[model samples]
Target chain A: MSGHGLVLRNICKKFGSTNVIRNLSLNVIPGEFLTLLGPSGCGKSTLLRIIAGLELQDEGSIAIGGREVDGLRPKLRDVAMVFQSYALYPHMSVAKNLAIPLLMRRLCAWQRIPVFGALLPGTASRKSEIIEEVARVAKSIGISHLLDRKPRQLSGGQRQRVAVGRAMVRHPAVFLMDEPLSNLDAKLRVQMRAEIKELHQRLGVTFIYVTHDQVEAMTLSDRVAVMLDGELVQVAPPQEIYANPHDRRVAEFVGSPKINMIDVNVCGGRLAEIGGQVLPSELTIGQGTLTVGIRPEAFHLASSGEPNSISAAVRLVEHMGSDLFLHLDLTGVPDPIIARLPAASGHIAPGNRLHLRIRTEQLLLFSENGQRLKQQASVTPLREYAR
Target chain B: MKHCRLSFRTLGRHGFLAITTAFVIVPFIWMVSLSLKPPEEIFQASFSLLPQSWHATQNYIRAMTASPLPRFMLNGVFICAVIVVFQILICAPIAYALAKLRFPGRHVFFNLVLVSLLIPSQVLALPLFILAYQLGLLNTYAALVFPFVVSPLGIFLFRQFFNTISDDIVHAARLDGMSEFTIVWRIMLPMAVPALIAFSIFSVVGHWNDLFWPLIAVRSQELMPPPLGLMAFKNEDTGIDYGPLMAGSTIVVAPLVLVFLLAQRWFIEGLTSGGIK
Candidate 1:
């Protein structure tokens, strides 16, 4: 089957008085796995439901496979969803659950009666065909043995697989998953994440996955759309989103331990000063106040008499197996500067004095209103350094 | 000394339970014993747990032959069954909508149901009797069954039960291409087995033993339910036959007890499961 692309244009949704999704537009390419990553109550799940036709947007148009599907029901839209709760029928066997969509679409009303249907002509063969298809899907997902068991008898992970299997059996053009792995334990979540990635690869169907977990978005998505407060802040590949975020909220929301912010003064169109120390820079912006964002990994231990080095006292050090995060109290800085270094870098203790250095290329500059400021390519030093 | 005190508390609790159990069970035992006794042995001053003479077969035969008792029982079964089936059909959908769907005046409708529940059936008996007479439905099955077809208790019980089910399951059914009709009957109905069972018990028992409505609505012997027929047997113009009256009472009460015994497990399970959830 050919995979279909989805386009959601200018979608705006309001719940009573609160605007949940505000003029949001996104285009998902065919056979690509796109993730909408955001915090809880950020309207990501509402957007997915709107695409599936489970909820109608207050103002917007949605097109699946080049056809507008604004008024179509979920089943008619050819989209299947794997919910966060799995939402399996607790009383039916796994096989019956998987066969429901197919049966509903294919069989007539009279042909669906439990015992009488078998007595009708051509029903026996059709039912066998459905059973065969269900078996094939079950075997592919490695849940063939669970076909006879009810949902209550299965573990969380098994039920998750069965849910996925149910969605796959329909062969829908698009698969929408809403936090499908949040119910599983930590270890099982990782395993299921890989399985979902594999399934997308095997089927080559367009997937629009919504999740609040950053790691899931980073590890599984070909492109991640970062949303904040019901608006699309940034949409790019994971590495670009982490490094070259268009908005400050995207930068702060994606990374662990958060990117550190320090206010710096740009002097004479080239020079930058932090904490009363004039630092070397290649910036050509006019004299103004700028906020500098520095990742913890960008800080390195200063060599003896190294240029652009700042002295600070270590307040705390957190050992995280392969890396050590040092909380340093820099002079004239209100908040502690956190630096991530190699675990075997040196013998460091609390209450010790140390020097740290950062390269100019690793520093990001933002205007007072949290907008990124482009930097000039030419290198220029302060007048003191020129002397 | 501590062990002794604990044993003393256990004994006191068990003793209290034993007294209550006897108080409830003694009347039933006395009824059965009286039904088994001959006419002379029933009035003796001395009380005994078992009848002095075994006249169970004779009494049962006379009760069956006396005043169309079997026909009355059949009417009772037919009326109760029809009433229960209609009640489920009428209540389940309204209950589902009230519990899950949003609409204007939903709360007002539910409040009306609650208020209707507080107003006992006896209060409506006169108006209902007049309406039945106007419709020419008296002395018919419609008169016996129509008043209870829409049960406020059934709707209330089913609404509470349906509220306990997660809405996600209903959404999943919709995504699976099921119409609302199929979702209610196929999905919600099967999931509501316990509630349905409990409702069936309540409806059957209430309508089966009811003497008030049938007494006012029905005038012909053919339309008399078991309770009305039993009353007729007691107050026959010939005389009061205590032995046959007791026998007929036993027959009238046996079916309800048998039904409870058969569905006792499901009855308790349905009530407790809905409560815990």
Candidate 2:
């Protein structure tokens, strides 16, 4: 069977009085690894459940491979789901768990009754075929030796692989995973992430992965949809999301050590004042106050007054082996300004006064309402703002 | 001083435990003693712990012949089995719905079920008797088994067990292209075995010993359960033949004790998993 792309149009879901997903629409291209990246309570898992037919959308329709699948149940959708808990059947052996879907498909309804099942005709041939298929999938996932073991007998990582194998045996067109790696310890999480990525490539199936981990989204997905409070805020490539975040929340949510944002008052023209310093004119003044975003890596230690420089005292220094994260105390800034510098610089120490030279091009400016300011081409990339 | 203090504390704990154990064991010891004693010694003011003479076989024969005890035991077993099977059928699906299925009024339904938990079964006795009378089910096992088929407590316990099961298993089964029914049977039910066994013990013991419902529902001697049969035997003998009555009571209690001892591991495991949280 060919892997089918999925399209969700204006999907709306509400849990009683609370709206979890509001008019959300998305598209998953065939054979593409798409990730829904968001913080907890962002409704990413809810959206994936809707696509898999595990949940129904209150409004709008779902189409798989360009066919409306609104009324069909989960089994009819040809979509497989790997759950965060690794939902291995506890009593069944690994091989039996993998063989269950095939058995359901091949065996007639009456043939499945416990006492009469053995008496049914063609069961032996069908059972052997399912076992063969299960073995093949188990071997592919390097779990052939574990076929006789129950789910609880296996370790966390082994259970996860078996969960994937159980899904893989079905050869579903689209695979829906809900935080599949969240249960693993950090080291195992990283290892399993690579294995899932490789499996996706080898299987060439449409993968819709959901995770609250931005790092996982960035590293594993070809495209990422950032959701917040049940709404899709931005959908783009990982690099684009990192370099050109559409909203202030996206910028804050996507990075480690987080981006530092400061509020600024705009005078009439493109000039804005921040921290009692008269900044150069690079943006046309909008209707209201604006917020400027500065990434940690954008800050550098400069000797004296530069075109874009701020004065501060070193509050703390965190040595990260190859890099140093400096926490600087600014005069008017409410939160401490963080800067990432190369370990070789060795210029920062707690209580030492310093001048922070910021790469003006790398600086991002946002409106007071948290919308990104469109940058003009002529102005330095970081300094420019929308008219 | 420290050693003396520690020794005193340990002695007090063991003393308390021994007293409690004796308190629980006294009634059982008396019942066995009465079962072994002759009628004349039972009414004596100065009581002995053991019987002067053993008439265990003779008492058992009279108890068996005095009432339809063989039939009564059969009735108890049959009613308990019917209740358990019906309870499983009715409660399992309802539990699945309460635990996993999302629909309108789910919390309201759940709260209503919780309300039922607060109300004791004794309160329902009169209404159930009346309902059975109206249905013309009096003197039949239907009256005894029908009302018990749907146990609110069973539903609540099974629901709690089902909820503890990871939703991932259900989702995985769904993606495996298994129907909702298959997911319930193959996925949810297997995980719910411990709960089912726990419910069975609750059901079997509850129905086996119950005298009130069957007492009210059935007037015929043939349909009476073991407990009611013993009650009938006492009434027929004018409360004088203590030996046979005690023997019958002993017979009635043996099956329950044996069953409990045999399945104590499963019973405790199931209870701890399903009830103790």
Fnat score for model 1: 0.61
Q: What is the lDDT of candidate 1?
A: 0.87
* lDDT values for all models: 0.87, 0.85
List model 1 lDDT by residue over B152-245, tens digit each: 9889888888888887788788888888877888888799898889889999999999999999999899999999998887778215566777
DockQ, every prediction = 0.70, 0.73
Task: For model 2, name the residue pairs that clash.
Answer: A270-A283, A361-A382
Off by over 4 Å in 2: A273-282, A286-288, A301-311, A330-334, A376-387, B1-24, B61-68, B105-137, B219-221, B234-239, B272-277
What tens digits encode model 2's per-residue C-alpha lDDT throughout B1-277?
A: 9999999999999999999999998888788888888888788899898877777778888888878889999999988999999988888888889998887898898899889979978899899888988999988989889888888888888898889888877777777767767766777778878777777888898889998888888988888888988898799763778888888888888998898888888777777887665
Per-residue error for A46 in candidate 1, Å, reads 1.2
Contacts from the true interface found in each model, as a fraction, amount to 0.61, 0.97
In model 1, the runs with Cα more than 4 Å from the true position are A264-290, A376-387, B1-24, B237-239, B273-277
